[model samples]
Target: MKRITVAVLLLMSFTTRYGGQQTPSRPTVLEHVTVINAGSAPMSDMTILITGSRIVAVDRADATTIPTGAQIIDGRGKFVIPGLMDMHHHLLNGSFPPRPGGIQANLGRLLAVGVTTVFDPSIGRQDFARLKAAAAPDSSAYARFFGTGPMFTVKGDTFADADSPMPETPAQAEAAVNDLKALGVDAIKIQRDDLSWAIKGSGTLMPLEVLAAVVKQAHTQGLKVYAHAPLLKLAKEALSVGVDGLMHGIVDEPVDAEFLGLMKKNGAVYVPTLALFEDVADVAAFARRQAVNWDRAKLQPPAIYAPFADAAGARQIESFLNNSAFTKERLKVARANVKRVFDAGVPVVLGTDTGFFGVFLGVATQIELELLVEAGLTPAEALRAATINAARMIGKERDLGTIEAGKFADLVILDADPLADIRNVVRIYKVIKGGVQYEPVDPATPR
Candidate 1:
């Protein structure tokens, strides 16, 4: 992960603090909606009552009473589910020195697509305060932002950006964890892979001792450690070191019994960014057939794709295309591994490495659900991965996930039932964040 410049932070702070939308003052009620609570079976003819920023009640519509003067939204034919959470969303643009309006644009696009919360795994430590301010519940314009500070990596690793801390020794690694903890980071992200799949030659991996120290210190600080381990060997090493989650599934090969045992023993969560790998492989395949001309206007949402229409985007695409065979194989292995791991009782949460080339913020999340279904997960199980499972990954299930009373009233009202067909998740009718109903916008249209 790279550091967001001070300039970007200033811009974000200004926009988030002073230029945000207001939430509704009146209590809102959704009556007769089919509710997919994510944790339990879908409930039909449910009534969800929202006051201020919390859900006050959720009961059978026939058994509930409508408060006087409440804003009654007739959800008679709609399906309501917990707002989507993109666990691996990058708040910063994929490119360096992120494009102007990139942060605000990504946030809006995510909210417009029913993503009420986003977790950035590789944010700069200096940007957390501003991110928190931007994600305040009062400002219902964007998805709530949470992130791990800079990702820990070793020195001289090509994948480590200029801003990532290269803690070479155990002490340095411990210090890095302490620094992030002081900054109030949500979690710790460490890189363990050698990047052999993307780069040739002997790629450097983080020292085992240093990786161990980072994980131990992070756990001691009451933070979970998520490792950027894509290969099986690195995944095993990360799990052995007591990391709480694998940011990506094992991509090099099918998962074995030993790996499953380690995952079960550690009670670690598997965040299979299936959409990330599929996007790369799909882009490469497209490039093979024609010239890689990413026309922004041709995209469904031009603003979202505009940032990637430049030379930076081209380079990212070309680099992956150069290793198309490996990339394709990675996607196949990752998909298979997700099913195997999920079947083995290892928790699987939804995460999309959005902001990468071709992985649009909110759009990729929908794609991830579809991909999860393709990987053998039932539509209902796939929804749980993005809803309850994602909240569990961040230890916020008590407050954020499910449709129970007393939780934040973050919901997505869909025109169709996602449990019947996962693609129906994109049939977003309205998005309610913190009891505020935000009209979903067309990304192609200017703000």
Candidate 2:
């Protein structure tokens, strides 16, 4: 076994070692391992070869030939799975006071914990470009970044804030999509609720007519549209307009037959951020959880959200979490709806809405997987939501989200089988992103 020393990892060159020596440039090999490709059964005694940033080969250990000068990783008892993704998150760090670049500092922690990919539904073009540049392959620490540039909302939407692009008419909606495309966004996020008032009282939710036009125009530019509709009514409206995905779960009530049928017919992906709802549903419990884990998270290197991890930030988060936004019964329905959606053949993907409230980055993706399993998804199926299904949602299936030949070599080496216990996802032994290897996080001292 080899150790990865943090001191040797250069921020500029992106280099690594096998046994405390300079690694060769030929290729990297993981020999005699068990692989879970998410959509398929586990394959044992396999050899995975990485050259440059792509996986060049995946064959049985006995049939594969060892290339000269290649760095070989002994994986006799390891299990490998594709790097996980947090499909719903916020990318901007400006909201947090006392420090800026919050999201930028978390890039290294994201890669350290096997979150090699992330999808932020709300971000500005400038921030997205900065995140993308920070996560470039040549950088020593980063996660593959994909996001919607500036979420769309109504004129007075509370979540819209100052950074959101508010579109009031069909023409404005069309222009908004065009502007986002011009900014090189990977997708468009449209909010169907104002959130300033009660869900039922919020006036002038993004008009359905305008939303339809936005969806149509975004499709013309080949960008997927993700809907942020927290309530069932709003979600139904978003679905009626044919958005590609729903970024939040239907928490107010169980999804009805009409919504399920619409989802099935339209092939709309669902990202049930159950963990987030759990935090919001039981504020006392959430506060307790925060009190216990806040220190550990703050100890992490780079301190991505150092401002938010401080006493003032903790007080703010506690005040926010203590507010009873949704009922306990609502969360029950939300969980049931997630199970129902999964059983009904709707694509239920894993997402934790990280970078908001108590949903920490790096670790939230793992919690989301466990929550999915609890919501009646098989471990493999839950894994798919974070891997292949997520990639497919963003039209990136051909390049990422799996351990296959010709795919980016982004993977996680685990000490235990996640199939047996979803919690094993946290027991990471190593992380490899874009064929670049990294030391895994120790749960006792995560950094």
Candidate 3:
């Protein structure tokens, strides 16, 4: 994929912020909406007051008056929740074997699905550097994109290739981290497994000594480090090495007391990214059996994804769908382990690994929330994973997670109650990002 210069991308991103209109920092009120904030029960007939981009008040409609001259929105019978976050997102144009697309359009598609914040765990440094430079400060036009500028992997690791900085020693690991920090990345992501382990059944895993050194260097720089560990042993190694988060579920087997202890000691956040395994299996199985009766929902493709739709990306999805059985057992193990880990008191964060070929952006977030519930978490718990828990994972808990006074007014208005059914989250009626109303893209349209 060709890269769009920062200037061009920023211009396109700016236009999307206010829907080609001037963005206002004025007052607004959402009246009589059913509020669900901070993992609590629904509070109906509430009026949430917003001034500029911060929520000023969340009061009962009968108790407080709407500010004069403020734009008033009737939110009757609508369920209001914090704007969703995807802790494990990606940009196909920025990953290995780059796909064609502009970043701005993809960001818009993410917003269209009510995702106000996104964290890409593994992104190429050059791509992240360009995006960081292009995005405007205090811009509300697109969902937030934070990431680790490329992933740290060993020479023989799955993602190793030209441009990949494969560290071979502990000294190299620390140096690699320092290089990433210099690029102004938000966090550090380390790859622990090789890609071929799933298909060809042969791959080299990153050594523990090197990972520990990487984690130490990252923490010294005040950056949280996340590890891409898909198996139980590798997950334990990452946790024991003091990684701040695990990017995938601990599959291959159930967790044990020692694993729980390691997680507790390190306070590592678990981001199952269940959709990665699940989608791979589902698509692959369907394609293998040539099933056609399934509902093939259409997703609107942002202009940036056009190149992907036409080239190797399209072929990759077909190839993956034809190999669904490869991930079937792995996904089952992940589902079981997620439940056990959550039951053991580990914090679970929501991440969909969207933008990986078939993984749709905004739509995947809602699906992930439902999957969380299916893995033995209550709806409230699952909501928190995407909200406050997600915010916590990225160390932005005070600024952008939940819908609370003095926090950024990023919220989603649902046509039905999500507490009654998690699927209601996809019934997006309206989206408010940084206190500005955003028109959402219909998820039904195929991209």
lDDT of each: 0.74, 0.73, 0.71
Model 1 weakest 10-residue run by lDDT: 5-14
Please write out the lDDT profile of model 3 over residues 1-447, one tens digit for every residue. Answer: 221111110111122333233346345778899999756778889888776667777878877665555667799999899999899988442222345666655665565668888888877777787666544344446677788988887766645666566777889988888888888899998887645424555567777898889999999998998988877777778888899888988756778899889988888889998777775665433222211211121234244344334455545754634545556766767888888888888889999777665555456677788788988888889898899999988888998887788788889998998888988887778777766666655321311
The TM-score leader among the candidates is 1
lDDT of residue 445 for candidate 1: 31
Off by over 4 Å in 1: 1-24, 92-101, 284-316, 442-447
Give the TM-score (vs. native) of candidate 1. 0.87
The lDDT, on a scale of 0 to 1, for candidate 1 is: 0.74
Q: What TM-score number comes out for model 3?
A: 0.86
Name the top lDDT candidate. 1
User: For residues 1-447, could you state the per-residue lDDT of candidate 2 as single tens digits?
Assistant: 222211111111135321111232455788899999887999999988777677777888887777666667899999999988778866432133323456765666676668888888987778988877666543235677889978988766656667687877889888989988988889999888544212234456766898899999999999889998877878888888888889988887788899999888789999998867865565335434443333434324335444344667656654544434544557778888989998899998888877665555556667778788888888999999999999988888998888998888889999899999988887778887776677674322212
Error of 1 at 394 (Å): 0.7
For candidate 1, write residues 100-196 as lDDT tens digits. Answer: 3356556655666788888889876656667677676554466777889788987787657776878889999898888888888999998887767
Candidate 2 lDDT: 0.73
Instruction: Count the clashes in each prediction.
Output: 0, 0, 10
Error of 2 at 281 (Å): 1.4
In order of appearance, the predictions have TM-scores of: 0.87, 0.86, 0.86
